[model samples]
Target: MPSPSGENPWSIPENDRLSERDFGRIAELIGEHAGIKLPPTKRLMVEGRLRKRVRGLGHQSLADYCRFLFDGHGLTSELVHVIDAVTTNKTDFFREPTHFVALEEKIVPALLERHASPEPRIKLWSAACSNGAEVYTIAMVMAEIAARHRHLRFSVLGTDISTEMLEYAAQAIYPVAMVEPVPTALRNRYLMQGRAPSRRSEVRIVPELRNTACFARLNLMDTRYTIDRDVDVIFLRNVLIYFEKATQEAVVSRLVGHLRPGGFLILGHSESMIGSNLNLRQVAPAVFQKS
Candidate 1:
């Protein structure tokens, strides 16, 4: 059959062959290192992404890349690139504005009522924070709210597996086109226009807002990352769809483990705990509370 592009699907050579044992090895390697599962289907997907890497690196086959990964060359770096390629990071300023509104109206107030004391602290994690927009948006909201409530403090921790994305996040800069949907008042308050070192002058989030958040390179698959301070809310949004059933369960368990008792866990609107079987109770629309 011809593909939608009108090219014969079979005309292309079978670029990669993923054996059952190789699939198991891929799953074990990814799971042990990054808590990601490479099911047979996803293993094929990985093969497709790495097929070009094989050509680029002058390797004979996908098996060669696997061997390179095991020969102490530490393909974790390359694996991270593969993840960056496969993971979709489509987000914008206040993409789901209602959740921020709810946080401002209901959640933040409730958290303050309980924890508003000397050095009162609130910790939030953007588990799959991509390119920093969501993290910065959360920071802007918290900073605005905290300014009004002197008795409370808040900090945001944005973590992602892609070092390339983190570099953009750390720079705290975005192009003008990316800021179109941002409201003017908020844009002026939170973002400033200036020349980057190379990309010329561009719009950037104000240092005051940027200062309130921190970005880290983290792989969500790591099971032992226990953030010492209990988190009040976690924005593990829009990133779980790529995982398989068992992998999704393991990731949720690790996520809930980091969540403080009674803390809220939010996922992408399309994602749900219906089949996830995680230990969380539905509190609001698309929102789950740790038991």
Candidate 2:
């Protein structure tokens, strides 16, 4: 049978073909476990990603690999690898800078007006902080705020579903080009370049920002989050595009539960909360405030 789009379904290399049934099952498991919705459209992408895992694990066929994930007995370690492969982790420093601009221009000033106190603490959560860019971006902005308002304290809690990504975040080491988008002054202030020969082409987050930040593994499918109860901002950008509407609502609800009453919730530019039925009021492009 021709593919739904009137092209070859088996266009993927015959050596690493992912059958329709296996793709469906994998999609279902990923959706159920990680709240990531995978449809037939993602078959090629999924196949390309999981193919590496299949080869690395020495599974001769895609069927054997799927079986290892679904039916194989008592191999929890393989499941983590499969889930890690299926999830997307595309992000970089100062991504969606307008949001950070908004934080400085509108959100933070309003927060200061309402929540200022002795030894003030501003807690923010980078909900889908892929790698470490978004968390450190928040840290950089907060670092600026802290310098100006010496009384204010800033703490960022970065969370993700994939342990591998969280591990990368914990180290806070990234390529040289990754920090290139950061302006010169901020880059010098917040990033440390590796020395020649051994550690070339790399930069790590400065120790002070690293000390102010922390990371945790969190699957948005869960009902309760493992972060602090109250937070002033949540940067859940770009990741929700992978989830279906119902999944988005469920995840947003859980995130909303952790946000302070008047705190800000920022979604990706493409994602939306219209008719999401959550108790949030839109304040900017993809930005919302909990009422």
Candidate 3:
């Protein structure tokens, strides 16, 4: 129904649309800062995502919000929020089951066999961990292995550019439906159900597994990463599709530098074409090993 002003209250005002110039500027900013492309076709998505920021800042339209962001000295404070708004963070527990199977059956045993120390530590990183699912899944696998192999120690690191996601990851809470992909045995071992009525639909990662994982905010576009250089495995999955080829190559190369010799680098199945030029050998589908 139309409002008293003779406009549809449920409809967005025409003036709220993002102008082409603003969209271009936003695209440029996001590309330069995050290495993720935002072509003209993504303008609607960008506009829709930024609407929350616009309303939060009390702006009447996209133009006003952009002006505040670009011209009125809001960029320094608003840039992270803008990037968070536009970034896509679709993920699931055990999104690709094969990757974990290979990690367990092949990667861990191989790394352990090559270790020189009597007690060795295996480190796994989730390079674009969205909400901690992948890292927790990794911890679960490692925990089960550690049960039998008393001399083995493992830690998992989950990193993403989104602080919001980092917070969510650190909280280690997830909706019941999101964890259905987890196996029954691992789920029973690593997950704890919420007891209260209002929280019954949620599950929290077991503290034992949570202690084995840590979360950090890291940007892939940076020339250097502050992470350790001796990581045993790095999961750079399901994220390269958002980058251009050059950015993909650069990010993959930098991540490879962090891997120890013989360490594994795993990409999403769809991103297998990337990193062929790097000093890596294909070990399995979507998996590479640094020499």
lDDT of 3 at 29: 93
Best-performing candidate as measured by TM-score: 3
What TM-score does prediction 3 earn? 0.95
Q: Arrange candidates by TM-score, descending.
A: 3, 2, 1
Model 2, span 1-291: residue lDDT tens? 554324455564665667898899888878888888887888877877777778887998777887777788524777677788889899988888899999888888878887858777889999988798899999999899889987999899998888889999999999898888798999989988898777789999999999999998888888887777689999898877788877888788888888888899999888865324677888888889887
- lDDT score for candidate 2 against the true structure: 0.83
How do the residues 40-129 of candidate 1 rate in per-residue lDDT, one tens digit apiece? Answer: 656545666556666787877767666776665746567776566445567787877777887788777777767747667889999888
Off by over 4 Å in 1: 1-67, 70-78, 116-119, 195-201, 274-276
Each prediction's whole-model lDDT (CA): 0.74, 0.83, 0.90
lDDT by residue (119-172, candidate 3, tens digit) is: 999999999998888899889889999998999999999999998889999999
Give TM per candidate: 0.77, 0.90, 0.95
Model 3, residue 227: distance off in Å is: 1.1
Candidate 2 clash pair list: none
TM-score of 2: 0.90
